[model samples]
Target chain A: MIAKPLALSLLLGALAVVPAAAQVKIGVVTSSSGPIALVGIPQKNSVALLPKSAGGQSIEYIALDDASDPTATVTAFKKLISEEKVDAIIGPSGTPNAMGVINFAAESGTPMLAPVGSAAIILPMTEPKKWVFKTTQNDGLVADKLIEHMVKTGIKTVGFIGTADPYGDNWLKVFTEGATAKGIKVVTAERFQRQDTSLTAQGLKVTASRPDAVLIAAPGSSSVLPETTLFDQGYRGKIYQTHGAALPDFLKLGGKKVEGTILAASLMLVLDDIPDTNVSKKLAVDYVAAYEKAYGTKPATFGANVYDAGLMLQSVIPVALKTAKPGTPEFRAALRTALEGVKELAGTQGVYNLSPEDHSGFDQRGLELITVSGGQWKLLK
Target chain B: MNMQIVMLLGQDGVTNGAVYALLALSIMLVFSVTRILLIPQGEFVAFAALTMAAMQSGRAVQLGWLVFALAVVATLMDAAKVWRSKGREPWPHGTLGLLAVAALALVLTKVLPLDRIGMFAQALLTIALVVPLGPLLYRVFFQAIAAAHSLVLLIVSIAVHVALVGTGLLMFGPEGGKTEPFSDAFFEIGPAMIASQTLWVIAATLALMGGLWVFFGKTLYGRALQATAVNRLGAELVGISPDLAGRASFTLAAAIGVLSGILIAPITTIYYDSGFIISLKGFVGAIIGGLTSFPVAALGALFIGQAEAFSTFWASSYKEVIVFTLLLPVLVWRSLAHTRVEDEE
Candidate 1:
């Protein structure tokens, strides 16, 4: 009788010592509302679905809505760290907003994982934060993909219309570099402030050059009409738009004009449509299915990245608790070490190979070229 | 050399020029009487149209447009009464009254929960709020202010803009704007390939311009406003209060802005700060017309709009590069020429 009671007590003690059986806290900040509300809504949905997708340890989500603003993102990050006391933080959606948090995230030794932001600020900064990791492909990959597709499609001469912000600046640089590298000629490139009403000058100049295709980089709904005017004016050249332009809101704004517009998007968009039987694929599918069942609309790239981002952080906390003592820099570093060592772990999006040099962790091949056929995304051949 | 290419450029210019003329007239009429460059004229245009569209933003509002138009006119009338009542009313006399009306309506317009922003909703909201507003405001706020010199009113116009933007920020919340195309009720016009809404804009703007030309050149009331703008005190000494003509001018200017708002609303998207941009472009157009010539201002708006399309069609970035390039050099040359004439005067 004494032996039986002692064995039961020992079993309970062993369970308490095991790290997998323990709960972990992680903070997430993303745009859940505002003009870019459509983008943030998806990320928020995907984040909630990640733990259920993982059959093992349950993750406690501390989601803070940044309202898609940079200032809000900064404040939320501080709140999440001090008030929420989250172990690690994930996401600050837009490139501009994400850039605002880089210095603070590194200084506080709070390891941050950027899900979908893509500007030049996170990496190659004067003070590169080794603690920071990004999972979303940036302008370079998008531009390179466009150029490759253009070259293959025999689009020698191309024109561009872009928004006038840091986002547009990155687009111009990457697009030009990619086109030049691929031996494609640039006909003309024009920049406009976000508020400008007409794209006529830029449109006319580029159309006159006889470009085989036109590339647009504007971030908002302003460029849609000028884009449509391209067809109405009888410029039969193909149009290749960036992933930044791949917004459902654009279709609503642009109407029939967005019907034929081509865009580069993440592999996650076509994830549900594709055939996959593996555990990771099954997990992602089941997660997406459950998420959609709970919330009507299918999970978008924003949600998918954050969901994977949560999973990535979830995997890291166990190693952080295992090899070292809690509340120490050594423990945080080892956790960071474990994250960098992440390889062959099939994520919701794809196999994430997070390394020191590669923060996006995926290459150009990870993306797919899709077009709006009859107002729905169709795989482009 | 290419016929299709030529047609495209031509069509683009024509459509752009029409919209610009309406905007120019709206600003020019106000400027002539008030001698105040109301830079936020475009915002008025956008707001009225946006409000109207937002009110009837579902499937095509077969009879909604007429109802919206009436509502706009009534709101304008109320605004006129409020402006006329200022100084005689309970509130301390100033722009505070017009600011209150504009502020209240401005917020109400932006916060509407429409699934898809219909054609011209932004423009409509701007116009509806501003049209009746100008007369009311002229009586309450601008009567004494305009009695000052033309240049002073110009500077004060900056205050007007500050109030509009600040109120807009407070009420609507900061978000960019968007609108659904009028493709649902769209029927192509031979070569134009425009929506029924766009065609409606073309027709109404043309009719309004034709009517305006007749009224200004023929009507007695129109002549009185013109006299007031030329020499305010002299006009009052003759018989007209100059203040009364100022009221008429205010009404006409607001009406002009509203009409343009209606036409332009169907074509483009509207944002909270869209007024500032519209004001700048319209100013450039007015400058092209010497800022005193309605016909010239109207033409300038059209020219600039066409030039934007032309540049965007041919340009690499498809932005407004050509308009600025053309505007800067011409403005410099015109400025020098005008200085020489002023020196002689």
Candidate 2:
């Protein structure tokens, strides 16, 4: 009887001890069901494709949905840090949602990988922002490439139409500065809500300005509207779009109207045409293939943003493991340090070379100039 | 802005105004008859537009299944209510009819080559699929609590709207869709060019409003509905069923909502959650009408559309702010104009 009781107690104690030291816990928060669901759904789905085991340690992810509400994102971050004790956290996909959780993640000493568009999350490098890293290319980097193409094409004047949100505000700021530096004039700047039923007024105003080219800055499929409206309004000037319009739906929705539209986005769009030697090309292809196999559709670049976060964690976990054990404050700090030390780490979006001052360390290699030709994304040679 | 710009903006405003006018009428009709705010009226618009887009893209429309599911739940609730009132109830004929309508719609979607069918047939099929949902929703969510306070009803309406938005996301996914235009032709008037789709929207709205006018003025059922809207107890004493009035008004509201959706789908890209803002504008119009006057509501919606368009031209970022601010003056005027206090029964 004594032997049986002792054996049972031993078994219970072993079961409890094994899981605590065996797995690395990571929490994921995504706005999978609200206004920004266009960006959040894919990121939520990509959580399934993240590496299950990294650096010989099994990983467990606790995923939560914030419904695109900023307050909900903060609550989710707090719960993940205090209740689940995750070593790292990924997502809360919208720029606004990601911006809301920086202080919480910093207070908890947890590393956060935000897959949002704005560069403001890491720019100026505050103490709180140092703990946050962005997965997507910065608006300024993409804007520079666009400005280069505009100069090459001898475009003199450009009209700007963007959403009244952070994504558009940041793009406007960066594009205005870059265009002014390059001697290109921005004639008219207009804004619209994502849910607006019509853009005829904005389209008319932009067309009346009579710029050589018009640039539309909005995220997801919402970017297709201003262009289509412009096309319908008899504006035949060249149209330029931001990386936000890089999704396949842009082609499907714009159809024949979007022909000759220029943009700068990730290599994932032209994976078939990109050189095989490119650092991120192979990984992007593999990710696309795996996602298609699992979901029966190609993954959007937004999903790849989350998957790249997984890749970053995969590379840094081993380095952090040498310093401290998982599920502790020291381990999270070590993970943050290891992430900052990441150099020439290729992800689906781009190569990440993080530093103490720059949390979103990406250069020109991160984005490519792309255009729509014959209803498909084509590399602009 | 020049004359050309003014004319162009005015044309855009008129097109959007017609759709908003239809929404305002429906909202007023539903509120007057059912005493419910009908917040999810916008979901009908979104569902119809998305269903039409799905048909055009050759995807199997999932709205039929949603209608069928709502029907089943509603039928079960009705049967339970009947069993409680009278120990044993016979087969539910009313529910059976709704189920058959849902099943037929499902079968038609599967059997018809939706993409190849002409736009008219596709639209008719979408209307058939989406209209029954209004009555089913009325039955499932509102009939039992029909006697609740207006605030309670508004709260329920909000919940239904949120639930439908989530269901819309699950059914349609997150991408916005736009259908092919009815015609690519444009007519130039002076310095402005108006697309044929704009004319179609205006014509359809006029026809719908005319039909409503005739229905209320010339038909006995319409007068009965009017009576119920005016005095529920008096109508009930005269043997008019408030339940039938509620169903009829919801049916009318759904029809208007779907037609509005079909009209606007080609002119703009519409997402699953786009209907709330559109309907909110209609609600603003309804409030302007004091929730009773149809003509005033329709005119109010038109004013909103024009104000919104001009504001977009002047200060695009503050378009919504300008349009919604119009409501404050109207509300103040309405309060001063009507000082008689009425008590809720």
Candidate 3:
């Protein structure tokens, strides 16, 4: 009796230690706290809301919350794959995080897609890691639109407030080069970390220089944008903040002052008038209703991104399941191949037309200028 | 000095430096009196601004004047009691207390129709609440963790700040409290910006310094504090309780920090990490002054502030690099090394 019980206990322990044997599980990882946590929380909700039954398969999600650390992102992905035995993965979480986790996908041949990774990360990856894909808008496209807006407004001689991270820094670099080429004086370029609370040090410098208007290439963190607070403490100037500032969290936390704050976001979100070609309005109503039903509050842009990421994963799973099998390398490759066919899919933003070269899925036309008018977003024509 | 350089320097660095100096003094006062560094000095700044924004008073709560006066009086009484209990009668206690009161005065001066209280008032209110709030912090976590080593204490204190900040983030949301530009003040000095808010912080810091001089050099308890700092056991023999010294230090530090918060908040903008940054800069100021010399620390702050201004003007993006570079030479010199200031009385 002792031998039988001991053997059974040993067997159970081994099973627990081993990767769960060949059950269809999709791994999802994203940040959940710190400055990015505000955005990350929505991403978590997206993973949680991924349909329980998709394509007649009971898809199980191996979810991990990265908590905004690059180190944590890799570790979380590793846990989902090795321990949870997830057949496929969805993530990159953000640009830096996306860049950080590529090696795992590269080496393990575990097909992965970066839902929110910058285009730079996806563009640079070689054919070997063709499994890697991304869904975030490109900084170059954002920069192009920002430049166009500045040119249209006849606002010359602008300044850029950059962050220390790759996300904001990349956008700032592109905007700076683009704006400078357009004869706009790149007055001042400064940086602060995503976690930094006060932007006064930087704002004071930028405003003192007397830039015509400030173009903020900041991350999507409430703590990082010192522009609104700077305006309150007496720095006055026109602002063209990035999509990072587009979230309602910025407006809600920033309050009244967030009015007239100009930012570019994916098309079809919060537009007063319907766009010529879009689906977010039709889907937005239902998405908002469903989100409210599920989460009690209207979902943020971050939530929408994650929710769409789940949907994207769901779409790819059907095509992949046809060719891929449980515990097979061909299965992961098939999943990767199926994801590449994601063309002209109507996303919350606009039609995401993805190809080998076009990883961001949408271009400048896919975005629109959102002005916070009367405490709500009104997309400018 | 070249006028061009001076103008640029003033424009680039002076306003922020003024605020940094005030925060540094708050940190030094706590160290000078209690031989303890208040880690929550920054949180003090954050809370004051947050409270200022939240309360939007001077009229909302009835008899705003009374609540303001009571808060000031309570501060004075608390500071006074701590001093007297140690038989030192901290004369500067009321002066520092008054600094906190002035912060309240700022909110009052701006208070109009309840809804009309602009964001700067909210900013000032943030500074005010943040200022006194730090003392309450001493009554919390670190009071028990005081016996830990300096690094451990620092880590614990930082952890406390992060936890408090995170809690604030959850409650307030990522959108920071709104602030309006301080109205009714302008001290134009060439290219650099000096508004009522900046001027207020500078005045508060300087006045407190002068008051501190009187407290230390001219008064009985002030002298006792010096004695207590030098030799606590000897102070007791001569007549001073060590416990009083600690409480006085905590109250004085909080009062000073509140003034710093109030003075700085309007110009700097009240955000969750606002106070923490001030504390960091203040520590730098203290270190530059060898942590023992008040006048030296103040001077160090001014020099650092000016340098910061100059660096920003000349090398806007590399301003931090310049300040850190300045610290390197200061650090290398033995004369600038930190000296353990004996806290007696």
Tens-digit per-residue lDDT, B177-201, candidate 3: 4334456566657644455665665
True contacts kept of 3: 0.14
lDDT of 2 by residue, A218-290 (tens): 9988999999999988899989999889898898889899999999999999998899889999999999998
Leading candidate by lDDT = 2
Per DockQ, the best of the predicted structures is 2
TM-score of each: 0.68, 0.96, 0.77
What would the per-residue lDDT of candidate 3 be over residues A72-91, giving only the tens digit for each residue? 88998788777766777777
Best by TM-score: 2
For residues B18-99, could you state the per-residue lDDT of candidate 1 as single tens digits? 7677767767777766676776566566555554544544322112222233334434544576689974643323234444
Better TM-score candidate (1, 2): 2
Q: Ten residues in a row with the worst lDDT in model 2 chain B?
A: B87-96
| Per-residue accuracy of model 1 over A4-52 as CA lDDT, tens digit each | 2234222321211112333455677767654454456567666656563
User: What's the lDDT of the predicted structure labeled candidate 2?
Assistant: 0.89
Displacement of residue A333 (Cα, Å) in model 2 is 1.2
Using Cα atoms, each model's DockQ against the true complex is 0.12, 0.38, 0.10
